[model samples]
Target: MTVNRRFTLAARPQGLPKDSDFLLTQDIVPPLQEGEFLIRNHYASIDPAIRGWLEPGGNYMPPVPIGDAVRASTIGVVELSRHPDFTAGQWVMGLNKVEDYSIGRGDGFTQPIDVDAVPSPTAYLSVAGAVGLTAWFGVEDVMQPAAGQTVLVSGAAGAVGSLVGQLAKRRGARVVGIAGGAEKCARLIDRYGFDQAIDYRGKDVEALSADIAAACPDGVHFVYENVGGACLDAALLNLAQGALVVICGLISEYNSAPQGARNIWQLLVKTATMRGYLISQYLDRFPEGVTAMAKLAGEGAIVYDEHVEDGIDNALPAMLRLFDGSNQGKMILKLI
Candidate 1:
C-alpha cells in the first residue's frame, strides 16, 4: 500500500490563518478505479483567494468542508493512470488538493501543461497561469484605459498587481502603484516601470489618500484594486470623471470582517464606475489573454517575480505572507 500525506482544513480561520487551522495526516492510497489518474504534485499555489473558501459562509466558491485536503491550484506530473486519455509522466495543471498525491478524472481545472514552452514549467503557476490571466482580463477587458490616461494599481508588487500596471503601461497609461514597504515600492518604480509608487506602510486612510493624490495629480482614470479597505478608499478619493474601478481581490478584508469603503460618494460626484470581477467569468477568452501576456513577457515588455517556500510544512506561513505584505511576488509551495 502507498501512503499519501495530506493537509486538511482543521478549523475555520478567525483572522489571518494559523498553523492550527490545518492538520497534517497520512492515508493509504487506494487502488485506481477506471477513468482515474494519480498525480505527484510538484508545486502548490498559495493565494489570498484560498482564504475565502475556508470561511464558514464562503465567498465565490463553496466552503472547503472540514477534514478535506485544503483546496489549492497545483501543477504536477501524472504518475499513474487508469484513465485512457492520460498517460504516466505527463505534466498537468489544475485545482488540486494539497497533498503529495491527488486523484483526477481529467475534468474541471485539470489540463495538460506544456513544460518546454516557457523558461520553466513553474511559470504556468505565475506569469503564464492564473496570475497573468487575472491581470490580463482585468486590464484589457474591464479597465480598458486608453493612452495618456492615468492608472493606479494597489498591491502593486504582487503577481497580479505587477502585471496589471505593466499591461496598462503597454497601452500608454501613466501608471502608479501602491505597495506596503520601501523596498516593494522601489521595485514598482524601478523594476515594473510604474511612473510613481506609494508606500502604504503605517499610513492611515488620510495619509495614503494624500499620497495617491500627489502621485496622480491629473486624477486617476482607472484603479486596478487588489487590496481593499484603505487602499480602495485612497483610490476613491482620487477618481477622475469617468474613472473605472476594477475590483480583483480585497486581501485586506479577506481574513477579517469587511470594512466598507468610506469614500464611495466620490463615485457619484465624479460619475465614475466601480465593478467587481472574477477571472473564471472570462474563460472563453483565456487563450487570447495567455498569448498576449506570454508574448509581452518574451519581448521584455512585462516582468514578474516569485517567492517560493521549500515544503508543504511551510504552506501556512507562506499564505500569511500575503496579508503581512512580506511576499515579493507570487507565493508557491515547492513540494518537489
Candidate 2:
C-alpha cells in the first residue's frame, strides 16, 4: 500500500505558530473508487492566511479539528484515475490535505494547468493560485484604482503585496510600497518598478508617514493593505479624498504579542472606504480574475517575485517568514 505523509493540526497556536503546533504522520492511500482519481502532489502554498486557520476563533471556514490534516490547496498530477473526466497526464489543483498523494472526486475541483503558458507549477500556487487571484480581484473589483491616482501597498514585497503594487502601477497610478529592508525596498522600486518604496525596519511611524507623503505628493488615493497595525497608521497620515482601502490579508496582527494599530480615525476623517474582503466571496468572479492576472503576466505587466523554499519540511520556516517580514515575495514549498 502507498502512504501519504501529511501535516496535521494538533494543538492550536497561541501567538506565532510553532513547529510543535503541527503533527506529521503517514496514512495509507486507499484504492480509488468508481469516480475517484489518485494524485501526486507537486507544490503547496504557505501563506499568512494559514495563520488565521490556526486560531481558535474567527475563520472563513470551520477550524481544523484536532488530529485532522490542515486544509490547504495543492497542485498535483493525476497518477491513476477511474474517473472519466480526468486523464493520467493532466495536471490539476485542488483543496486537499497536505500530503504526497490525494484523491479527487472529479467534482468542483480538477482545475487544469497549462504547462506551455507558464514555466513552473509555482505559478499555479502564486499568481495563478489564490494569492494571485486575491491581488487581481482586490485591485479590480474591490479597490478599482485609477490612473493619476496614488496607491500605497503594505508588505509590498510579499506574495500578495508585490502583485498588488504592480497591478496598481500597471493602471498608471503612482505606486508606493512598504517593505522591511533596503534590499526589499530596492527590489520593490528597481525590480518591480514601484515609484517609491519605504523601509519600515527600525524606522519611526512619523518618518514613514512623511516618506509616504513625499512619495505621493497628491496623497494616497488607494491602499492595498496587507501588513496592518502600525503600517495602517502610517498609511493613514496621507490619505486622499474618497480613498479606497482594500484589506486583503493582515500579516502584522496575526502573531500579535501585544496591541497594534493605535490610530483608527484616519478612515473617518478622509472619508476613506476601508473594506476587508475574503476570497470566498468572489468565487463566481474567479475566471475573470484568472484571465486578468494571466493576461498581465503573459505581457510582462505583472511582477511575480517568488521566495521559494524547496521541500515540504521547510513549510514551518517559510510560513513564519511572513510574520517576521523576511520573505521577498510569494512563498511556496517545492515538494520533490
Candidate 3:
C-alpha cells in the first residue's frame, strides 16, 4: 500500500498563516479508478494565490475544505494509470495538492511536459508555467505597451513581475520596477535591464509617488501591478493621460484585511483604466504563451530565478518566505 503524506489545512489562518494552520498527515493511497491516474509528485509550486484559497471566502477557486490537502500546482511522474491519455512513467504538471501522490482524471490543468525543453522540469513551474504565461498574456494581450511608453511593474523582483518587466522592455517600452530593497532594486536595473528601479521600503504613497514622478518624468503609461496598497496607490498618482493598470496580485494585502488603494481616485482624474486580471482568462491561448516563453528562454532572451526548498516538511517555512519578502524567486518545493 502506498502511504501518501499530505500537508492539510488544519485551521483557517487569521493573519499571516502560522505553523498551526497546517498539519502533515498520512493516508493510504487508494486504487486508481477508471479514467484516473496516479502521480508521484516531485515538485510543488508555492504561490501567493494559494493564500487567498485559505480564506473562508476564497478568490476564484472555492476555499480549500478544512482537513483536506492544501491545493497547489505540482509536477510529477505518473506512477499508475487507468486513463488512456496518460501512461505510467510520463512526467506531468497540473493543479494538484501538495502531497506524495495525486490522483488525476485528466482534467483541469493537467498536462504532460517534455523535460528536455528547458533547463529543468521545475522550469515548467516558473518561466514556462503559470507565472510566465501570466506575464505573456498580461503584456501581449492586455497592456500591449508600445515603444517609448513607460511601463511600471510592482513586485518587480518576483516571479511574474520580473518577467513582466522584461517583456515590456522587449516591446521597446522603458520599464521601471518597484521592489522592496536596494539589492532587488539593483537587480532590476542591472540584471533585468529595467530602465529604473524604486525601492518601496519605508516610503509612504506620497514619497513613492514623488520618486515615480522623478523617474517617469512624462508619467507612467502602463502599470503591471502585483503588490497592492502603497505601491498601487503611488502608481496611480503618477499615471499618464490614458494609463492602463493591470491588477495581477495583491501580495501585500493577501494575508490581512484589505487596506484598499487610497489613490484610486487618480484613475478617474487621469482617465485611466484599472482592470483585474486572472490568468485563467487566457487559458485557451496557453499553448501560444508557452511556445513563446520557451523560445525566448531557449534563446537566452529571458532570465528567471527559482528558490527551491528541499522537502515537503519545509513547506510551511517555504511558503512563509513569500509573505516575508525573503524568497529570492519563484518558490518551489522539492517534494521527492
Candidate 4:
C-alpha cells in the first residue's frame, strides 16, 4: 500500500491563511481502477488566485471542500496508468491537488507535456504556464496596446505583471509599472525595460495617483491591473480618454474583506472601459499562447524568474511570499 500525504484545507481562512487553517494528512493510495492514472507530483504552482478559492463562494471554481487536498495546478510524471491515453513515465500538467500523488482520468484539466520543448519541466508551471499565458492573452488580445500609447501595469514585478509590461513594450507602447519596493521598481526599469516604475511602498492612493500622472503625463491609455485596491484606484485617476482597463488579479483584497474600487467612477469621467479577464476563458487558445511564448523565450526575446521552494512542507510559506511581496518572481513548490 502507498501512503499519500495531502495538504488539506482544515478551516475557512480569516484574512491571510495561517498554518492552523490547513492540515497535513496521510492516506493510503487506492489501486487504480479502469480509465485511471496515478501521478507522482513533482511541482505545485503557488498563485494568488488560490487565495480566492479559499473563500466560501470562491471566484471562478467552487470553493475547495474542507478536509480535501487543496486544489492547485501541478506537474508530475505518470507513475501508473490504466487510462488509454496517459501512460507510465509521461510528464503531465493539470489542475490537481497539493499532494504527493494525484489520480487522473485522462479528461478535464489533465494533459501531457513535452519536457524537451521547454527549457525545463518547471517552465510549464511558469513562463509557458498559466501566468505566462495570462500575460500573453491579456496584453495581446484584451489590452491591445498601440504604438505611442502609455500602458500602466500594477504589481509590475510579479509573475504575470512583469510579462505584461514587456509584451506591451514590444508593441511600442510606453510602459510604466507599479511595485512595492524600490528594488522591485528598479528591476522593472533596468531589467524588464519599463519606461517608468513607481514604488507604492508608503504612498496612499492620492500619492500613488499623482505619481502615475507624472509618469504618464499624457494619461494612461491601457491599464493592466493585477493588484486591485489602491493600485486600481490610482490607475483610475490617471486614465486617458477612451482608456481600457483589464482586471487580471486582485492580490490586495484576496486575503481580506474587499474594499471595492473607490475611483471606479473615473470610468464615467474618462469614458474609459474596464473588463474582468479570466485566463480560463482562453483555454481553447492555450496552444497558441504556449507556442508564441516558447519561441520568444527560446530566442532570448523574453525573460522570466521562478522562485522555487523545495519540498511540500514549504508550500504554505512559499505561498505567503506572494502576499508579502517577498517572492522574486513566479512561485513554485518543488514537491519531488
RMSD of each: 1.4, 1.9, 0.8, 1.0
Worst 10 residues of 4 by lDDT: 106-115
Q: Which of 2 and 3 is ahead in TM-score?
A: 3
Write the number of the candidate with greater lDDT, choosing between 1 and 2.
1
Q: Residue 241 error for model 1, in Å?
A: 0.8
lDDT of 2: 0.80
lDDT of 1 at 135: 92
- lDDT accuracy of residue 186 in candidate 4: 94
| lDDT of every predicted structure (CA atoms) | 0.88, 0.80, 0.93, 0.91
Q: Per-prediction count of colliding residue pairs? A: 0, 0, 0, 0
Model 4: per-residue lDDT, tens digit, 147-248?
Answer: 989999999999999999999999999999999988999999988999999999889999999999999999999999889999999999999999999999
Compared with the true structure, model 2 gives a TM-score of 0.93
- Writing each residue's lDDT as its tens digit, candidate 3 over 283-322 gives 7887888878977887889998999999989999999999
lDDT of 4 at 226: 89
The better-scoring model by lDDT among 1 and 3 is 3
How does each model score on TM-score? 0.96, 0.93, 0.99, 0.98
Clashes of 3: 0
Per-residue lDDT tens digits for candidate 1, residues 1-336, read 788888789999899788889998889888899999999999988889999999998888899999988889889999999999889999988888788899989987677877776666777788878898899898888988788899999999999999999889988899999998889989998999999999988998899989988888889999999998999998999999989998999998987789979999999999999999998897777677766776676667788888899888888888888888888889988987
